[model samples]
Target: MKLTIERAALLKSLAHVQSVVERRTTIPILSNVKLEGRSGRLSLNATDMDLDIAETVPADISQPGATTAPAHTFYDIVRKLPEGSQVEIEFKPDDGQMTLRSGRSKFSLSCLPVEDFPVLSGGEFPFSFTLTSSELKALIDRTRFAISTEETRYYLNGIYLHAATGSDGAMLRAVATDGHRLARAEVTMPEGASGMPGIIIPRKTVAEVRKLIDETDGEITVSLSETKLKFAFADAELTSKLIDGTFPDYERVIPTDNDKVLDVDCKSFAQAVDRVSAISTEKSRAIKLSIERGTATLSASSPESGSAVEEIEATYDSTPLEIGFNSRYLLDILSQVEGETARFAMADAASPTVVREVADSSAIYVLMPMRV
Candidate 1:
């Protein structure tokens, strides 16, 4: 490919595309990013055989051609160039080298045949809809922390994205769980989104897609089929394979009969959990919450480390309750709550507890207790 592109634009597109390329891939072509210059534009593509990203940037194309070059190396060359410098890239078909020239600097990189690059096909999508960037980003940020990392139960590995009927109306819901805790968040369903099939978006794909979703307020077109999903925004598109497993019935895990209520400031609760966990054992990392009357005390004890205790005022009217939880999991769910008060409905010391914001009803979280 022969093209002259602005350095800043090329670097921005490379930042999004090169991350999909593994640093030490076994396949030679997989380590390289394919570049195509055609019709006054340049296209960059990279894939890891599972998730693929393709980004296009405006360019001045002198000749139309295609080739593959080392993804990170090419990115570094373009990144180190001075600000506002224009980059000139040409593929020498005779010797199979890609030449890059900027200012007085000149470098030639070995290239592979572009035909060897893998393309992840997003088969036909029966359901398609549009959502604002902020809407999609909020869904990912609120629920992504609870995605399971265990390899055995692959069903809980990613977010369960589907449509649900909420108290407000039809909603788009995202749920994630790892046996210890679960998070469920919903937003108003955009137009024509009720027919989208529920799918387990793999953890990696969710992460990569989040990087592509910026902080803008523009609309993004989403298309999904049985086996694949695609996110299209701006001049970039991401296509990924869905996890091939059935998500467990998450509704069964959410507690509905809990009556004991504890209301506390969300920031203070998280801070207390962080403080007491300092003395917790590395293996268990458990912190116990002892609630009585109107006060709650968070305490942790370990054989090697000393004990830590922090008390916070809470509104609890039921009998004295003591529950244990992993400090990290407690903070993870609490951080998602933006309101002033975090309401917890606890059935007992052994059962799972339901947490939600006192003012917001769109998001609910369930946390399982640990043995003190």
Candidate 2:
């Protein structure tokens, strides 16, 4: 394949596609990106068996052909090339080596047969819908942090997305939990999403799609089946296989009838927890919250590191309550609140605490209390 493309455009597409290629792979072609040049455009594809990313960019085609080259190496070479320089890529059919020429620099890299690269079959999609870029970003950013890293409970490793009925009727919800904490976020459901199956999108795919959505304001076309999910946005597309397992019933864990309500500034509360937790033990990053009539005091003590105490003004009419929570969990939930104030609803020190953005109750977070 021979093509001339601008460095900036080439690098942008390369950056997206190459990130899907694994740094180490048992299969030779899996570590390389398939480059296809035909007509007036160049397509780059890379996959790690479970997930695949394909990107197409306009180019001046001199010879129509295709080949597979080392993903990271080719990306690095083009990234380090002089800015704004036109890149000429030529593949010698006889020797199977791809030559890259940009200004004064030239390099010959080994290539693999394009036929060896794996392409995920666009399986039969039973359901499809479109979502705004910003909405998808909000769902991922709010819940991804709660996905479990534990390999044993593989089902909890990705955000659980499906259709649900809320106070506003049917809505698209994304829920994630790691046993200790849970995040549930949703947006107005599109017409066709009512019968969509609940799918657990792997953590890696969520992160990749997040990056793609942030780069553009275009709508994302999502297609899903029983086993796989696909996201198409702008010039790029990502397809990933769903985790084959049943997600736990998350609703049962969310505490209801929590009578105590504490409203405090989200930023100040997070900072206070962070400051107090500094002296907490490494094993248990616990910060105790003692709430009374109109104030909340945060304290942390370690056998070896002494103790810390900080108070933040709050509005609480319920009886005094003392609860301990992991500092990291508190910070994670606080970061998701868009409003200046956070509302914490608690039943007792032993029960899970419900957290919501003071200005919006549509999104809720649940945190399990810990022993101080």
Candidate 3:
């Protein structure tokens, strides 16, 4: 393959595809990025068996061919090149090397046969829909923080995406949980999205897709089948194998009869928690929130570290209650609250506390209390 592409363009595409390549892999081909130059475009593809990414950038193609090269090495070479430099790539099949030239620098990288690269089959995607970048970002940003990192419960390691009925009408929802905390976010269901089976999008795929969202404001086409999911961006595509497991009935964990309501300024509450948690034990990271008529005090103590207490103004009408929580988890949920006020509905110190923005009903968070 012989093609000339601008350094900026090539680097941008490489940045997207190279991340999908696993740094350590048993298969040599899996560590390389497949480069195809044809029809005035250079397509870059990289995969780690379970997740795959393909990106295309404009190029002047003199010879239409394909080859695989070390993904990280190629990316680093192009990245260090001067801006506005023209990158010329040539593959010599006989030598099994890909030559890259830019400015006064030249490098030859060993190439693997293109035939050895694995191709993730594009299965039939029966349900496809479009979501504006902003909408997609909200869904991911709100819930992904709670995605489980535990390997045993594979089902909880991804965001559960499905269509559900809400108070307003049909909605497309994303829910994630790690047993200790849960996050749920939804948007109005887009066209052709209803009746689709719920799918668990793996944590890695969710993160990669989120990064792509930062690059464009255009709509993203999301298409899925039973076993796979694909997110099509303006200039790139991400296909991933969905986690094969059944998500628990999350609604059962969401409390419905929480009588105590505490409304606190999101910023103040977060700041107080951060300050008091400085004294929390490293293992538990526990902090207690004592809520009374119109104020809340956050406190943390440990055998080694001294105790800390910070009072923040709050609006609570219920009887005084003290709840213990993981300071890190509480702050994570608080950071997702977009509104100025964060409303916490609690039954008692022992039950799950539901947190949500006072003005936004589309996103909700649930945190399990810990014994202080």
Candidate 4:
């Protein structure tokens, strides 16, 4: 295959596809990207067995053929080339080498047979819907941080995307939890998702799709079956395998009867927790939150290190209550709020805390308390 393409355009597509390729792979072709050149376009594809991404870009094709080349090396060569320079890629089937020429620089990458690349294919998808890029990005950003990194409880390793009843009737909800903390966000349900199956998207797939989504006003077409999911956005398309396990019942964990309310500035509360936690030497990163009448205090103490105390003004009218929580977990839920004030409903020091943005009712977070 031979093609001459603009450096900027090619790099844009390469950047997305190459990221799916893992540096070390038992299969030789898994580390390479497949390039197919036709009459007027070139397609770049990369996959790591479970997930696959393909992006097409405009190119001037001199010879029509296909080959696989090292993904990272090719991407690096294009990225480091002189800005605005046109790149020419030529593949010799006889010698099995791909040559890249740009201005005064040249690079040769070893090529693998395109037939060796594995492409993930899904059966007919009965459910398909479209969502604005911004709306989809919001669901991911708010919940991705709470996904579990624990390998044993693999079911909690990704966000649970499904249709559910929201505060205002039916809506699409994204929920994620790692036992200690949970995040839930809802969006207006789009059409054609009524028959969609609840699916657990793997953490890696969520990350790759998030990277491909840009700030444009384009709509992404999402299609999914029982075992696979596809996202077709702009010039790129992604396919991934669904995580195969039953997600735990999350509704039972959310508190609905907690009435002790406290309203405080989200930024101020997060900053205070960060400062107090700096002196906490425990692996749990625990910090105490004491609220009474109209003020709240945060304190952390470590026998080896020193102690810290900070008082912040809050709007609370309940009896004095002291609760201990992991500083990292508290800050994580606070960072998702965009509004100035955060509302916290506590039921004592033993129960989970309910947190939400005062002005936004579409998202809610739950944090489990820890022993100080």
Q: What is the clash count for each candidate, in the order shown? A: 0, 0, 0, 0
**CA lDDT scores, all candidates in order:** 0.92, 0.94, 0.95, 0.92
Q: Which stretches of candidate 4 lie over 4 Å from their true place?
A: none
Candidate 1: give its CA RMSD in angstroms.
1.3
What's the lDDT for residue 315 in model 1? 96
Candidate 2 residue lDDT tens string, 129-204: 9999989999999999999999999999999999999999899999999999999999999868889999999999
- By summed lDDT, which 10 consecutive residues of candidate 1 come out lowest? 209-218
Worst 10 residues of 4 by lDDT: 208-217
How does model 1 score by TM-score? 0.97
lDDT of 1 by residue, 1-372 (tens): 688999999999999999988888788999999999999889999999888999999999999999999999999999899999999999978899999999999999999988888879546988889988888988898899999999999999999999999999899999999999999999999887887889999998888889878624588898999889898988889898899999999999998999899999999899899988999999999999999989999999999998999999999999999999999999999998999999999999999999999999989999999999
**Which of the two candidates, 1 or 3, achieves a greater lDDT against the reference?**
3
Question: For model 3, what is the alpha-carbon lDDT of residue 133?
Answer: 99
Which segments of candidate 3 are over 4 A away from where they belong?
none
Return the TM-score for each candidate structure. Answer: 0.97, 0.98, 0.99, 0.97
- How well is each residue in 1-372 modelled by candidate 3, as lDDT tens digits? 899999999999999999988899999999999999999999999999899999989999999999999999999999999999999999989999999999899999999999999888477999999999999999999999999999999999999999999988999999999999999999999999999999999999999999999998999999999999999998999999999999999999999999999999999889889999999989999999999999999999998989999998999998999999999999999999988999999998899999999999999999999999
